[model samples]
Target: MPETYRVAIMGATGAVGTELLDLLAERNFPVEELVLLASPRSVGRELTFKGQSIKVQDINQIDFSDIDLVLASAGGSVSKEWAPKAAAAGAIVVDNSSAFRMDPTVPLIVPEVNPEAVLEHKGIIANPNCTTILMGVALWPLHQYQPIERVVVSTYQSASGAGARAMEEVKQQAQAILRDEKPVTEAFPYPLAFNLFPHNSPLDDRGYCQEEMKMVNETRKIFGVSDLRLSATCVRVPVLRAHSEAINIEFQQPLAVAKALELLHAAPGIKVVEDWDANYFPMPMEASGQDDVLVGRVRTDLSHKCGLELWLSGDQIRKGAALNAVQIAELLVKKQLLKSKTVA
Candidate 1:
């Protein structure tokens, strides 16, 4: 019989949290017991998992000693407070937040790009930012063919990246606009309906927002290239889910468009969608709810012989967040790294 383990889904009622629950069942993870954890106010709220109704336990009161794996989709502050505790208690925590991503001791991972990194984790594994995960899944294969000299990317992020409330805000705002009424704001400072804006994350002195910097630094960490050159502009569009990115990559050698397409098609976690006749390429609508990153529009940069350009879209919540975290847990189990072990 397959060895089943106890699994905990932190922040069990949020957008990514809900997806985690569904994925655990859909993927048929070897789960012996499923625990739903949330804030105090959410305590007693029941969530369904694999046809079983599990009540949300207060994070503060739960004992992590018996859990074998924890899929944490809670925000950073929540992760910062509890991830270590869970780890110390012997649960391998796969955190889907920015909390410990850059920590030298933690392995920041995308299973498709760096599954081996899971073996090096002390206790917690950090899932990359949504945009970074999408880009890495699509570009890592190409980078392996030839070292990437530099990368320039601009992201069209969707409202779902902000959270469930933000997604609702976009819908309500759009409806208000259609009715010729004023749109109210809470999740964002500005209206996200019918208008797009630069990512609202805190801005640094370099004028790049925190979201943009995550792409630069996190990509370097995941690729094991400390000196990888990358610049990104993250913008939030009014879409409900999924994210789109335009990528320009400079390589040491000139890689042909046909070769790029061939490589991408052969790569796992990527689906190449292109049709010159229709001028159609990967779009957010098609990429939503997909596990694979939809990639297409392979072309040579007109200016630089060694530069190539491409476009990709992926479901920010699925592939970008929940699915990636689940994949990491799957990797750990497959490698037998989820044995009886505790963080030192």
Candidate 2:
């Protein structure tokens, strides 16, 4: 008999939450039952899955005891409040927030880079930040070939990372600008249309914003390297979805461009798209809605013999958040790591 699991999406009506629902159906996960959960204002909203309409339920009312897997994409606050309850109620959580990511106890996962780490999870797996996940997936293969000593990255992030409403706000801002009207500043601290700014997350004493630090700290945790030298600058671009990054890496051993291309081409979850003749490379438009991270512009850094530069773009809402969480759930099932007490 085929084994099936009961699954619940903690923020089913939100951006990442909606993507999670689509991925579960698109991947044909062995779901015997599906439940949609959201905040009180979103309750009773209808979302379709596998040809059936499932009404969004308030998370407070759902019984986690029967759910084998919880794909949580709600904000950090909600996850902090509910994730422990879900885990204690016998549900394995794959959380898509910053809430438990830096928690040393939870294994921060990017399945392609660190599948073995999943085996150590007690009841939860934390997905890396979108930028970190994309960079990890694209760079880990090369790192395996030659250890990376340091990384410097700059991100061109889309409004979708802020949420679906933020994306919509960008559109409205653009529309209002066309009429020469003042752009609204509700979704973001400043107008995002026809303008860009440094990531607005809170800053640390060292001046790194929370988003930038997430890449630094989360990368070290996922790669299991406590001292991996990395720094990042995150910027919010006007694009509605997907994100692009320019990465410079210093390897412990000398690596050639051809060798780097060979490693990236053979890596999982990465697509190489370089057209030197036309100077074409990965773009946010091309990467939007794609599962694989698009990587290109591989070249040797001019300043250092052991350093290399590359560009990559990926769907932030997909592989970065929802799809990664779904993949972790699949990994748990494939490895039989879901606690026996939770598996029916």
Candidate 3:
């Protein structure tokens, strides 16, 4: 029998955190003990796990000595402060925030593409952004066939990527607009009902949103191709869950659509759902709540050599956050790197 792990989930009350709990149960991850941690505001709230109620605890007060792994999705600031403390106490921290992703010593991992990177972690392993994670999963298989030189991608990300509050904000605003009342815009900069926002995060000096920059940087790191060129446009769509992307890639060698389909079909963690003639393609509704990244609409790019264009979709909360983090933990366990001494 495999050794059961004692796990702690930081931000257990949020959307991604809640999804993490569901996934842990769904996958039947060997959990000898589970600790649910949240902010002070959420303490004492009841959350059901494995058919039993588990009370949420304030993350600030918990001791981490017994935790085998810490899956943190609380936010970058919270992760920045607490992840190291958990690590120092001999727990392998798999963080979902951007806090430690770009750190030279911390391995940013996507289990399908870079599981080996987990072995190089210094107690903390970073999960790639939701958009980046799905994109890398689809692109890695193609890259292995013919080296990709550059990519241009546009994302239609859902509100759930922000949090449960953002999801509620969209729903509430839509109803308010129907009732002729002014819609609230606290969670987002603009009304997210029947509209789209081009900026997914604060703009950098170069005019790219932080979310876009993450896709560009994190892709390079995960693929181990630092000089690869990538340009992205990330937009916030009004959809409640799942993110969709249109990507065009320029590769070193020519790849046919039939061959590309073959490669993608065989890729791990990817599902091909293409049937253009039948009016079938990857969609947000279908991708929501799914664990696999769906790919379709494969064709030749008109403007570039060895070029290919495709559409991809996945649950931003699952493939993007929770499931990916848990998958990393599974990889650590499979690699025998989840042991406390290995992390320390």
TM-score of each: 0.98, 0.98, 0.97
- Write candidate 1's Cα lDDT for 1-344 as tens digits: 77788899998899999999999999999888888998788899999987788999988778999889999988999999999999999899999999999999999999889899998999899999999999999999999998899999999999999999999999999999999999999999999999999999999999999999999999999999999999999999999999999999999999999888889999999999999899999999999899999999999999898999999999999999999999999999899988742321
Worst 10 residues of 3 by lDDT: 335-344
Model 1 error, position 81 (Å) = 0.7
lDDT of 2 by residue, 225-312 (tens): 8899999999999999999999999999889999999999999899999999999999999999999999999999999889999999
Ranking by lDDT: 1, 3, 2
In model 2, what are the clashing residue pairs, if there are any? none
lDDT of 2 at 273: 91
- lDDT of the structure predicted as candidate 2: 0.93
Candidate 3 or 1, higher lDDT: 1
Query: How high a TM-score does candidate 2 get?
Result: 0.98
Q: How many clashing residue pairs appear in each of the predictions shown?
A: 0, 0, 0
Residues 121-181 of candidate 3 have per-residue lDDT tens digits of 9999999999999999999999998999999999999999889999999999999999999
List runs of model 1 lying over 4 Å from the truth: 340-344
